[model samples]
Target: MVSSMEFLRVANWVMNQVLVKSCYGVARKIKSHSFDWGDLSYKPLQQPSSFPDIVKCDLEGRGSQTLACDFHKVLLRTRSFFPYFMLVAFEGGSIFRAFLLLCSCPILWILNYEMKLRLMIFISFCGLKVKEMENTSRAVLPKFYLENLNLEAYEVVASVGSRVFFTTMPRVMVEGFLKEYLNADAVIATELHTSGCYFTGFLSKSGLLVKHSALMDYFGDTKPDLGIGNTSLQDQLFISLCKEAYVVMNEGKVMPRNKYPKSLVFHDGRLAFLPTPSATLCMFMWLPIGLVMAIYRIFLGVFLCCKFTMALGAWCGLKLNFKDNNQKKSESDKGVLYVCTHRTLLDPIFLSSGLGRPLTAVTYSLSKVSEFIAPIRTIRLTRDRKEDGETMKRLLGEGDLVVFPEGTTCREPYLLRFSSLFAELADEIVPVAVNVHPSMFYGTTASGLKVLDPFFFFMNPSPKYDIEILEKVPRELTCAGGRSSHEVANHIQKQLGYALGFECTNLTRRDKYMMLAGNEGVVQENKGRRF
Candidate 1:
C-alpha cells in the first residue's frame, strides 16, 4: 500500500495530466470542424489590405455599401477579453467569483483560445441572475467599451450606411451596447443557456457562433461591400467573402473624448479603473490594508477637529486642497448659503472639514447607515416645493448651510441643472466647486446600495478632493434683487462650471436614474426615513 503523502502527490499529478489533456482535446475538436462557406467561393488574398487602404478608399463615397466587422478586433484597443469577464463576474455575480476568475489566469494563458473562452464564460456567468447581467451590460460595460474604442476603426464604420458586428462573446453581454451606442443594424454572437431566469454557465445547444458561417447566413450569397477584421485565420477567412477586406493592426491607440460619437454623461459602476487580471490581483492584495486604513480615517474624522484630521489624513495618503475666495461678511444673524456642485456623497463632509466648522447639509435622500456615520448635521428634503423651501430657509436661519443644487452626484465633467429653490432661499449665495480623484474605485453608483458609497470612496489607496469656495454672487444677480429664481440658479451654475473647467447641461437627477437604474430617482420612505 502507498503511504498517505505519496498517494496525495500521485493524485495531484494525475489531475494535472487530466486537465492538460482535456484542454488539448477540446482544442483539437474545435480545429477539426471546418465551416462550409456556401457557394460564395472567393480565393483568399495572399496579403490582405491594411486599415489605411480602406481609409484611402474613401468610404464616404460608397453610399450604398454595407460593412461587416469583428467586434473586438475592429472596435477595441485591447485584444484581451479577461477584463470584460472580470467585470461580469464582479458586477453581475460577486467579488468572490471575480477573484476565482482572476486565480484561473495562469490556466487561461496556457489554454487555446476556444478552451480559455469556455472556462471564463463558466466562471463569470454561472449562477448569475439574468437581470443583474443585463443591468451591468447596460450601465457598466458601455463606459469601458467606449473608452477602449479605436478612433480609426470608428471613422470607417461610421462612414458606412449599414453595419453588422460579429463576436464570440455572449449576445446578452455585448448586444445592448453595440446596438444602442454604436447603432449597429445587427449583432451576431454566441447565446448562453438559461435555466429559467438564471444563467446555466454554459453555451446554448447551437454552441459558439462561428463568425464565417454567421456572416454567410446573414448576407446569403450576396457578399458584403466592405469587411474589417484582425490578423487571425478565422477573421481572415470570414472577411474573404466580402468584395473588399481590410485588416486592422493591433496598434495601441484610443479615441479621445472630444472625438467620441456620443457624450458619456452618466455611467454606473464602483470601479474607476479597468479590472484586468494583474490589476485585479493588485486590488485584492491591497484590500486588507485598505479596509483597516479606511476605518482609522473615519475614526479620526468623527472624533477629532477638522484641522487635526486634515493634518493627520495627509500622512495616510489623503489629499485635500482648499481655496477660499469669500469676501468678508458683515456681522449679521443670518447665515450664508453655499451652493456646491456634487461629485460624491462625501462632498459635504469634506467641505465641512475644509472649513474647520460645522455646517448643516441638505440632501434629497440619505441612507440610514450614512446618516448615522456622518460627522456633520444632515437634513432630508422632500420633493414638495413648498416644504423643501421652508426646510432650507429654516436651516439657513440657524447656521451656515450647504446645498448641492444638482441634487445628485455626477462623475463626468458636466454639472447637472441646478434647482432654483436655493437661489430663492438666501440673499447671500456662494458657489463652491468640488472635485474628487480616486485611483482605484468610484464613490458613487446609480444601481448599487447607497450605503456603501462613502466606504468605497475611502477604500482607494490614495483619494484626493479639491474644494474651491468662490466669491459670493453679486447682489444684482440674486433673486432678492428683482432677478427671477431661475436666472440666479443658472448664473451660479455657469460660475461653478467656468471655475472647474466643466460643461453645464440641463440633465436632471431623473434623467440620470432613468438611464442608469431604469427608474425615477425617488427614494421610498421606510420607517419614517427616506433612503
Candidate 2:
C-alpha cells in the first residue's frame, strides 16, 4: 500500500510539471505575437498650435456644436486620482481593502501612469459586488465630483449643446455622474470585466480604451467642433482629431458652492474629506486614538452631568459654541418645543447640554444603538399624523421637548421642508440653528448603518458644533393663535435658514431618500425600535 501511494505522488508531480510548461509555452507565443514592451513607452508628440484657454473661448454659437473633453483632466480641479479610488475601496469594498490599496502607494509612485491606474483598479474593484459599486457611484461619488469640479470647465461644457467625455477610469465609476449631473451626451471610458455579477478586477478583452481611437470611432469622417484636455501627449493626440482644441492648465480653483449646476442637498457617505494618499494614512493612524476618545466621550455623556461632560470634552478637542437669545419662558405650564435644524443625531444631546438640563428628543428615525447610548430621553415618532402628534404632546407635557422639524439630517447648507406636526403641538416655539464641522467623517448617512452615525462623528480628532437659540415665536405666530400649522412651520424654517445662512427648500425627507437611497426614508421597526 505504501509503494502504491509513493507511485501516485510521483505521477501527480510529473503531470503538474507538464501542464505548467504547456501553459507557459502558450503564453510566451501569444506575448511574442501580439504584445511589445516598447508600445507602453510614452513618446513625445509635437505641441498643437498655442491652444486658447477654455475660459476665454467665445461661447456664441458654440451651443450648436459638438464638444469632447477629458473628464479627469478638464472637469476636476485636482490632478490626483487617488482620492476617488480610495472612495471606491472604502465604500464599495472594505476598510481592509482600502488599507491595502493605501499600502501599495509606494509601488504606485514608481510605476507609470498606465500601470498605476491598472493597479488601483485591481485593488479597488477586485471581488466587489457590481450592485454595491453602482450604489456608491450613484450616492457617494456625485458629491465629491461636484465639490472638485472646475468652474471654467463647467461653463464650457454647459454651453455646448452636445458633449462627449473620455476617461481612462472605469466606465461604471464616471458614467453615472457625468450623464446625470453634467448632462453629458456620451461617455467613452475603459470597461471592466465581470463574472457572475462580481468584478474580476480586470479590464475587458479590449483592454484600456485608447482615447484617440475611441474619439475617432465615435465620430467617423466628421471632426468634433471642440476638444478639451490637459497638456499630456495622449491628450494632445486625442484633441488633434478635433476641428478645434483647447488645453486646460488647472490653476487649482474649485467651483464655488453657489456655482454648482445642481444643488447637492442629499448625499450619502461616511467620508467628509477627500482621501488623498497622505490624508488617508493620517486617518488610519488616528483611528486607534479616535476610537478610544469616542468611547470616552460616550461614557462621560452617559454617566456624568452635562456640565462635566462638556468641560471634559472640550479638553479632548470638542468645540461647542452656544448663542442664547435669552428669550423669557412663557408663564404657562406647557413646555417649550425647541425646534432645531437637524445636522446630526447628536443635535438634541448637544442642545440639552447647551441648555444645562435634560430634554426629551423626538426623532423620526433613530438606531437602537443610538437610543441605548443616549444620555437623555428619546421618543420615536410614527409617521401617522395623529399618533405622532399625540406622542409629541405627551413628551412636551412632561418638560421641554426637542424636535427636528426637517424630519431628517441635511449635510449641506440647506434646510428641508419642515413637518407641520411640530408647529401644531407647541404653543411656544424656539428655533435653534445647528451646524457641525467634522474633519474626517460625516456624522450622518442615508444608505449606511445608522448605528455608527454617532461613533463616526465622535471619531473625528476635532469636531465642532454651533448652537444658536433664536428668539421664541410670539403667541400670535403659533398655531394656538389661529395660524395654520404649515404657516408656523414655514415661519420657523425661514428663521432657522436665515440664522444658519442656509437656503430653504420645499424638499422633504422623502425627496432626500429617493435621491440618495432610492427609498421613502422609512425605517423598519425591529422589536418596537425603528431606525
Candidate 3:
C-alpha cells in the first residue's frame, strides 16, 4: 500500500497539472472560436465574442479521443512524469516535502467545501426572493427580513425604512438611493469612503451631495463585518493568521513617522496656523526674489555702516545704543495686534527677519502679488473684501492678522491715519516702531537730484535698514460710530516715535495725495541735510 505522504505527493502533482491544462484549454477554445472581420460568411453568436462555448461543445461517444486530449494537455502542462522522476531521483529525498504535501489535504478539502457551500446559498436565497416577489396573493410586508444568510465580505445598501435590500451594492447605488429616495443633501463617510462614492454622486442627475466623513478613534468597537462572496475562505483565514503573526513579530517595535505641525500666536495679536503646503510653496517660490533682496540689502547695509563708521571715526557717533523699554518681565503670554509705523521700503522684511518666531506680520494684497510668480505666503485682502464680515470672521478665527494701519509708507518714522481693518481682528495692540538711520538715496526726483525718502523703491531694493520691535500695548480705541481710523493711527505713531529715537511728524502732503489716490505712492521726498 502507498503511504499517505506518497499519495499526497501524487495528488498535488495531479492537481497542479489538471488546473494548468484546464486553464490552457479554456484559453485556446476562446481564441479559436473568436470571430474576425474576415469571417463574414460564418454567423456569430448573440453572446460576447470572448466567451468560451464550453457547455455547448459535444462530449459524446468518442471516449478515446477525449482521453487522448486530456493526456496531451497534462503532458503539455507538466512536461511529463520523466522530469519529476528525474528531479526526485537525482536529488536527495526530503521527508519534510512529503510531510508538507500530506498536511495540505485538510486545508484544500475545507476550501473546496466552502466555495461550493457559498455558491449554493447564493443561488438558493436569490431564487427564494424572486419567487416570493412573484406571489400575488401573499400579504406584502413593508420590510423584508433576510436571516440565516451569512453574507460575509459582501455589502448591502438600501434606505433605512426601505422594502428592498440591495444586495452586494457599491457606492454608486448607495448615492442614488440617498439622493432619489432619502432626499438628503449630504452623506457622511470616511476619507476612503468619500473618494470611492463622490464620483457617483457627482455624475448623477441630482448633482453631487458633498461626500463627507469624520475620523473617530476606534475604542472597543466590534470588528467590521464584510459579507463574503468571491473572496476565498482560505484567503480570509490566511489574512487573519498573518495579522496575528505580524503582531507577534513586532512585539516591542515603536516607530514615530514625524513631528506635529508647528503653530504660532502672531505679533499682530492673531493666532496663525503655521505654514501649510500652499503657504510653504509660496514661501519657497519667493526665495529667489528674497535672495536677491537680501544680497542687495547686505551690500547696501555694509556700505552705509562703513560710511557711518568713517564719519563717526573722529566724533563719538551719537552714542547709538538700543533699549527695549517696552519689554516687560511680568507680561508673558501677552497677545498684541502690532500697529507698526511704516517708513522705509524694507520695513516689512526688516521686521519679519528681526522678530522671534510666533510674531505674524500683517501684509497687503500687493505683497501677495509679488509672490504670484511664486507662492502667496501672506494673508491677502482686497479693500473690497476687507468689509466681508464673514471672510473676516473666518480669517480672525484662524489667527491674528497684522494690518499696516497707515496702509502706505512715509518718509519720516510717523504713522498715517489707520484703516478700520485692525479693529476687526482684536482689541489688543502692540505698537511696533521701525527706523532706518540717515535714510537712503531713495531715487531721482523730477529735477533729477536724489530724494532721500524710502517709498521710491517700494517694491524695489532697499540699500540698508534697521528695525525695532517693542512690547505689547493695549487697544484703547473701539470701532464705534464717529471714532475714525485716523484717531487710532495717531495714537500708534507717537508710541512708535518714542521707541525708535525719531521725531513724530504729521502726514506729508505727498502722503495725503497718495492716500487719496488709493495707490502706494512711489515718489521721492526732497533730500535735506541731517544734523
Candidate 4:
C-alpha cells in the first residue's frame, strides 16, 4: 500500500508532467502561429446597398422606396430574429471552432460568454453520499437561507452570516421545507441551493448568491432588502434594530441538546444567543515544503524579484501596506476576498509573486504552461453560480482568495463594471487597484491577437503597476440591507477609479466583446444563410 506522503508526491509529479507539457506545448504552438484557437475574423458578404423589397413598398402605401422602413418593421416584429442582423466579428467555420473550444473548456466558455449551464447529475448522488456519511451528525446552523430572517436569532446564525437571494422560486419551497421540518419560517444555513440549480461544488454554489441576487435586483435598483447578517457585530445590530423598529421578536431555537449556542436569553423581548465560535486546533510548528521545494521556492522568489524589479518593476513605485494592517487580518489569515481590476494576465502573476507568499488566483481557464510555471496558485472557475460561490467560501475557509472582479482585462484607461459575485463572498473584502504603465510597448488590449499578448508583455522594457491595497469595506456597512454586493461593487469601482484617476465606463464584459469581437464574444457567422 502506498503511504499518504508517497501518494501526494506521485500526484504532484503527475500534475507537473501533464499540466506543464500541455500548457508549454500550446504556448509554443501559439508563438509559432501554427496552432491557433478561437480566431474569429471575417468580412461581411457584399450585396446591394438596398434590396428593393416590393412587400415593404406595398406596406408604405406611398411607394417611393418604403421597403427599408418595412424591412426594419419586419425585424422589429420578429423577436427571435432581431439579434441575427447585429454586427458579428466572425462567421462560418470560425464560429464552430470557438463553440467547440468553449464546450471543451466550459469555464472559458463562461468567460467569453457568461452563459452558465447545469452540471451532470452525479452531484445529487454525491450530496446523498454526504447525507448518508454523517446523517446523524447535526449540521452547524447556517446563515442566509431565509430572507428577512428574524434577527433576534443569533446562535443559529453562526455558521453562515449572510445570504444573497438570486431567485424567486424556492423561497416558497425552502420556506416550506423549513416550516415543515423545524416549524420555523427562517433557516440559518451556511449555504443554500435550490433543487434545480444545485451542483456539487463549493465556489459554484457560492455563485447562487450572485445569481439569485442579480435576478431579484433585475431592475438595477441599488437598494435591496438584505436582512441582518449572522456575524457577531450584526447580531448586536439585530438587537438594536429590533428595539428601535419595534419589530416583533421570537425566541431563538435550542437544538436537541448541545447542538446550539452555549446560552440563550431574551432582554426586553429582544432575543440573544451565544453560539460558540468554531474551535481551531494548532499542532506543533511544521514546515510546509520539503527541503528541496523550499530551496527552490527561495531561489524562485529571488529570481522573480530580480527579473520583475529590473524589467517589470514589480513592486517599485507602489503604495501598499504589507503589515497585518487590516483589523480583520486575523480572519483573513484564513481567507480574504481580494477584488482587483484586471490590467493583464501578468496582473495576478506579478502581484502574487511580489508578495512572496502563496496567493491563489481565480480565472476562467487554466493554461497548463501558466500552471506548471506559475509563481502562485491559480484556479479556473466552472461558472456554475452556486458551485462557484461555495468554492470561494471554502477557499476563504482555507486561505485568502484573490479575484479580478472586472471579469476581463481592460487595456483602455477605463474600468468596466465589476462582477458583484466576489463582493458577496466575504465581509472582509480588500479592494486592490492595479495601475499598469508600459514603456516602449503596451501589454494590454481588449481586442488583439491572442498569441501576441504574452509575447508583447515580455518584450516591454518595463511595466509597472501601482497596487493600492485599500482599507477593507466595513462589515457593518454590508449588514442589514446597508449595501448589496452590487452596490459594494459599484462603490469599489468608483473608489478605484478615483484613486487611479482612470475613467470608469458603464460598458461591461459583454459590451466589450460585442463592440470588439462583434458578438458577445461567441457568434456563428452565416448561421442560417442561403447560398
Candidate 5:
C-alpha cells in the first residue's frame, strides 16, 4: 500500500522531470528550499489588475517559476508524466496504465457529475445574489450564465456585516462590465475564474471586500474610478457607486440663492396687512373690541331666549378668544380678501371667531364631507375633480372671500402647494399669517384629540393666544396678465412663506395654510392693517 507522502513524492518528482522541462525549466534552476508558500500573502492574488505583479514574483518559487509558461502547457505536461510513470512502475506487460486510466475515468465521471449538481445549486444561490447585487448596485448585470469549466471558487472576506462576495465571473462578463461601465477592478475576479468558481470582488479603500451586501449597505461607497482615466472593471463598479453618492450629496450642497418664503396664505385670504403697529392698532383695536361687547350682549339675549346651540357657538368663540380686526372700513372698500394660511379644521373657525365676521370660507371636498352640516357658509372644492374656474371667479368678483391656499398642515415649519382660486381674484389678495401656540390640552377640537400632559387644562390660557396679521402685498404685486395661474400661484406661495417666516423649500401656491402654521397661526399684536 502506497502512503500519501510516497504518492506526493513520486508525483512531485515526475512533475519536476516532465512538467518542469516542458514548461520553463525554471524550477530546476532555483533551489526548492528557497520557496516559502506558507509565508506568501494572498493580497496580490486578490487583485486581478496585479496579475503582472504575480508574474514578476514567480522567480521566488521554483515550482511556481516552472509553472509560469502559461497555465495550459503545465497541465498538458503533467498529464504526459502520469501514464509514463505508471507504466514504469508496473513493467512491460503492465495493466498499471489501464488501472490508472480506469480509476481516473471513474473519478472524473463522478467529479464531473457532482460538479454539475454543485454548479446548479451554486447558480441558484448565485442568481439570488446577482439579483440582490443588481438592486444594491443599481447597475445592470450580464444576461448569460457561466460555463462550469469557466467558473472558479473563491472565499471572500466580506463575512463582516451583511456583505457577501460573488467573486468569480466569466472573462467576457468581466470585460463587458469594465468596458461598458468603465469598471477596471473586475479583471481580477475574471482571472480568478481560471481556477474555477472564483468570486467577484471589489476592494474598498480600507483593503476590505465590498461585496454584494456591502454594496447594498454602502451603495455608493467604493468609488471605482470610471472617469476618463485608465481603470479596471472592479474600479469602475466602485467608482460608479461613489459617483452616485457624490451626486446626491452635492445636490444638497448647492445654496438656494433665489429661495424666499412664500405668501400663499395672505394671497389666498385677501386680508390686508400694515406692518406699522399704529396702522394695525388703528384697524383692528376699536372694531374688534366693539364687536366683542356687542357679541357679549347678543350672547346674553340668546341665552335668555333659550337658543342653546347659538349659546354654545358663542361660548366656543369666547373660549377660543376670537378677535377680529378693529378697523372699520366701508363694506365696498373692504376689497381685500383674507388669505389665511390654512392649517387645520380649526383655521376657518379660528379666523372667523377671531375676526368676529361671518367668513365665506372655502374648503376641499374631503373636508366638506364631514363639514356639510356645519352652520358656517363655505364653498367645497372637489379634490378629485377639476375646479370650475368660473365658480371661483363669481365668488371673488362679487363678495369678500376667505381662502386658505395652503391645503394641509405638518410638523415641519414649511408651506405646501397653494390654491389658485384666489389667483382669479388677484386684484384683492391680502396676505395674512396666523400662528397659534401649541395647545396644552390633548383635545384640539371636538373632532380630533391629542392629549399631551394630562394636567395641562389646569394651566392658565393666559398668553395662550398668538394671532398675527402681517403686512399685505398690494393688488399690483399680485395681479398680472399673460401668466399661467400656476406661476401666479407659485409666486403667491413664495411671498407667504417669506412673510410668515418659513423656508419655502417645497411650497406651491395652492397649498393649505395650516401646513406652515401647524395648529396655531402667529398672532400679530396690532388688530388691523399692519404694514
Candidate 6:
C-alpha cells in the first residue's frame, strides 16, 4: 500500500489540477456568453463603437462613427473574466500549464474551509479603499500602455485594486515609464475597472466591488527588484520586497536607520533639493513650548480637581456670551444638561472654566495622559450604545452634565448626528454652541491618536474658544405630546446646524476613522503584521 504522505501529496496535486481545468472551462463559457452592457451607466458601455471618440473626449464631434467597434466593448466586458485571461495567456495557453498559478481567494459560502493566505493580516490594514475615478465617456486606459510595449514579449498582466499595494500613484507611474523606456511587458497595478473582479479560488469568481489583492497575491516566488514607499509600517512590506528601495519621507530629512546597505533614502538633509529636517531637531523646538504648557495644565488641574475652574477661557483668550448675560449661575448649576455642538477637547475644558463650576463631561475621545494632566471630571465612553446609556444616566444623577450631542469632534465646519440620550438625561437641556479657532495645531482631529491630542492643542499659539449658551428646552416642549429620543436628537442637530452654519453629515466616528486610517470596520487583531 502507498504511504499516507504520498497519498496526501497525490490528492493535493489532483485538487490543484482540477481547479485549474475548471477555471478554464468557466472562462471559455464566459467568453462565449453575451453580457448585458446596458446595465452600466458609463456611456462607454452604452456604445462601444464610439470608443475612439469617447476615449479621445472629442469636443467638436469630429470622431468618425465608423471607428466604433464591438471589440473594445468586448475587451471591457472581458475584464470580469480577467483571471481566466491571465491564467491562460501567462502560461502559453493551457489547463495543465495554468495550474502553476498561485493565489488565495476569500472562501465563498464555506465555513472556514479552503484558501488560506499569509497576507490576510495585510489585507485588513487596507480595508478602507480610496477610489479615484472621474466620470467621462471614454476608456481610461494608460495612454502609454496603448501607445507602447509589445504584449507578446512577456507575461503581460494587469493589477486592478482598491487600497492594496502600498503602490497606487507610484506603481502607475512606474508601469507607464517602463512601457515607454524599456518596452517591458510586465504589468502589475491597482488600476481596475469599476465592473471588474478577479476570481480568488475555484468557488470565488470575480466581483465588481471585490478588491484586487483579495483575488490573488500580486508577487510570485520571485522577490521584487525594487519598490518605492512612504514611512508607514504597512509600506515597510513593499520596501522589503527589494534588495534596494527608495524611502520617501514626508516629515523630516532624516533617513531612519536601516540595516539594508543598498537602500536609497530621500528624507535626509543630503537631499538638498528637499527640506527633510531631522526628527530630533523638530523635538528640540517643541521642548520649551511643551514645558510651558505643562505648567498651565497643572494650574488648570487644581481648579478642575476642586470642582469648577473659573474664568478658564478668559485666561486663554476666550470670549463667552449667552442669550441673556443676566442668567444666574445657580439656575444653570441646578441640574442643567449642556447640549453642546461638537468642536474639540478644548471645548468642554474651556466651557467649564467659563461656567464658574465643574461639569461631568461624557466623551468618547479622552486620552489617559490628558486625563492625568487636566483631571476634568469625565466619564470616558465605550461607544457601546446600551452601556453608554447606563453610564450617562448615572452621571446625570451626579450634577450638570456637559455632553456634545454630536458624539465625535469635528475639526472642520461640519456637525455629525447627535445622540438622543441627552433628551432623557434632564428637562433643562441648554443647547450651547461651542466654537473653537486655533491658529495652529488643532486640539481635535478625525484621525490622530487621542494621547497626543492635548499636546497638539496646547502647543498652538493662542487657541480661542467661544461658548454661546442658548435658551433652555424643557421636557414638555421637546416631547410636544411625547416624541421619540431620535426625533428630539434630530431636532437639536438641525437647530445647531442652522444656527452655526455648519453642514450636517451622516458620517459617524467609524467613517471618520476609516477615512483617516483606512481601518475598515473590523477590530484590529494585532497592532502590526510581521512578515
- Which tens-of-lDDT digit does each residue in 1-531 have in candidate 5? 999646644654553344323322342223134422221101111223312211122122222110101111110111111222121111211223223332342233334322322332233222122322222121112111111001111000011111111222323233443333222222332121111232233222333223333443533444322111012334334324422111110001111223211122222111122112222222222233323333433333223322332333333222344334425443344345777765444455446545555556666522323254334467766553345554555666666667776654432346677766567654556666655443212112111211211112212111133345544544445555555666667776777677567666465432322332222332222321101
In model 4, the runs with Cα more than 4 Å from the true position are 1-328, 445-452, 479-481, 522-531
What digit string (tens of lDDT, one per residue) describes model 2 on residues 409-477? 999999999989888887888889999998888988887778888888988867899999999898899
**Candidate topping lDDT:** 2
Judged by lDDT against the true structure, how good is candidate 6? Answer: 0.42
lDDT for 232 (candidate 2) = 76
Q: Compared to the true structure, candidate 2 yields what TM-score?
A: 0.89
Best by TM-score: 2
Per-residue CA lDDT of candidate 6, range 275-386, in tens?
A: 0112112222433554455355445545443332333423432244533332634444346678898766656666666666678888775666666665568778876878
Predicted structure 5: clash tally: 111
Arrange candidates by lDDT, highest first: which order?
2, 1, 6, 4, 5, 3
The order by descending TM-score is 2, 1, 6, 4, 5, 3
**CA lDDT of each candidate?**
0.81, 0.83, 0.31, 0.40, 0.34, 0.42
Give RMSD (Å) of candidate 4 vs. truth: 26.0
- Candidate 6 residues lying further than 4 Å off, grouped into runs, are 1-287, 294-298, 301-334, 520-531
In model 6, which residue pairs have backbone atoms overlapping below 3 Å?
A: 49-68, 49-69, 159-189, 252-276, 253-267, 253-268, 253-276, 253-277
TM-score of 3: 0.30
Candidate 1 Cα misplacement greater than 4 A, ranges: 1-57, 330-332, 524-531
Error of 4 at 197 (Å): 45
Candidate 2 global CA lDDT score: 0.83
Cα RMSD, each candidate: 11.6, 14.4, 33.3, 26.0, 32.0, 24.3
lDDT of 1 by residue, 63-129 (tens): 6689999888568876677888888998878878988998887777667767777889999999888
Q: How far is candidate 2 from the true structure (C-alpha RMSD, Å)?
A: 14.4
User: Candidate 1: how large is its RMSD?
Assistant: 11.6
Number of the candidate with higher lDDT, 1 or 2: 2
Model 3 lDDT per residue over 320-387, tens place: 22234456433323344556776533454444434422333444423222333211124544556455
